[model samples]
Target: MKNLVNFKVAVKTRECLVQAIYQMLFNNDSVAKVIDQFKDEHKTKKVDFKMFSMSLRSINRNKKKIESILTSLEIKNSSMELIDKSILFFAINEMLFGNLDKPVAIDESLRLSKKFSSPESYKFINVSLDKFFKTLS
Candidate 1:
């Protein structure tokens, strides 16, 4: 029997995306390895796999560029918690390169931070992403 949980595809996809990125940061796993890892997890089966894969692939392909862009925000990711950095990287990449709208990317980033990071980390994520957007306008 399969255990199924009810989660919106977008929400679950982003949740897994953050975790996959965090895992990659720590383990330095290739995108294929990480996607295979997620695919092997029954708990993650409900995610929007296309969204998750495309986002992860885009990030993988463009992570350095995205990192440079976010680095320009002066957040000093070198000192950031890995989870926080992962969340910022995940959301900002989605905002700039993926199909999600900017607001949705940001909102989902905050939500992911709240779920997986320090209690106050979401606030920092919010301010950082906001600053990134301000520079764009």
Candidate 2:
């Protein structure tokens, strides 16, 4: 059932779901703290803890890949804020791991930026994801 939920999210709204996960990770104050809190809070439940753990590990393991994608797109150290990095990470996760269609990934990134980030930030995300998509082809 948990796998079914993940599969549905991955198939139907992969980019948005990855963006949500990245947002959770990036804004958690600290990854370790977040994990600790999650463990403490959810340990009593009979939820799919293993899948959640795998998702967290996958995010952590792909951090460098995410950063590399942003750097390749010239996001720039000076311009890359936490939110910007989170967008990049989510985009890369969708592109590399989530099985989302390319245009869907790009469009969803743009939409997420427009909804959650500043106007200027949306432009940055648009250009970056556009460039990243071009490289994939």
Candidate 3:
């Protein structure tokens, strides 16, 4: 179905978004550099490139606001893995700025954490982002 196809691309985009964020942290690359690298790497994939680029740009643009929220939650950067931190940043950015529903953002973040992070990281991500999500209401 068309919906299934769209869902795949959306999932791929979210995966890429989290990776891109991780790269920004892990590689110490500038947003512009990461964007360019991701574009080149995913040029032939079935990624929703527009959404990936927009979400990354938005996440980069709103870094300060996102950090402020995380600070309020007392989420210390060193305490979490880079992947978990990236997932939180992506989820919080989506919940705050992207068009997706908060639940979608949270669910996508959990999915990513389960796929790429430690077995127990999703629980931490869920609780932390849920706390952040509640503040938006």
Candidate 2: regions farther than 4 A off: 1-56
Q: Which pairs clash inside model 1? A: none
- Candidate 2's residue-wise lDDT over 39-119, tens digit each? 676566544444445555566778778767777777786766666666667777768876567787677677667666788
Candidate 1, TM-score vs. the true structure?
Answer: 0.90
Per-candidate Cα RMSD to the true structure, in Å, reads: 4.5, 6.1, 2.5
Ranking by TM-score: 3, 1, 2
* Model 3 segments more than 4 A misplaced: 1-6
Write candidate 1's Cα lDDT for 1-137 as tens digits: 11224446777788889999999999999999999889789453568777788889998999898888877887786689999999988988877887878887788788888889999998999999999878767
Best by lDDT: 3
Give the alpha-carbon lDDT of every model: 0.84, 0.64, 0.88
Candidate 2 yields a Cα-based lDDT of 0.64
Output the number of the TM-score-best candidate. 3
Compared with the true structure, the alpha-carbon lDDT of candidate 3 equals 0.88
Model 2, residue 100: what's the lDDT? 60
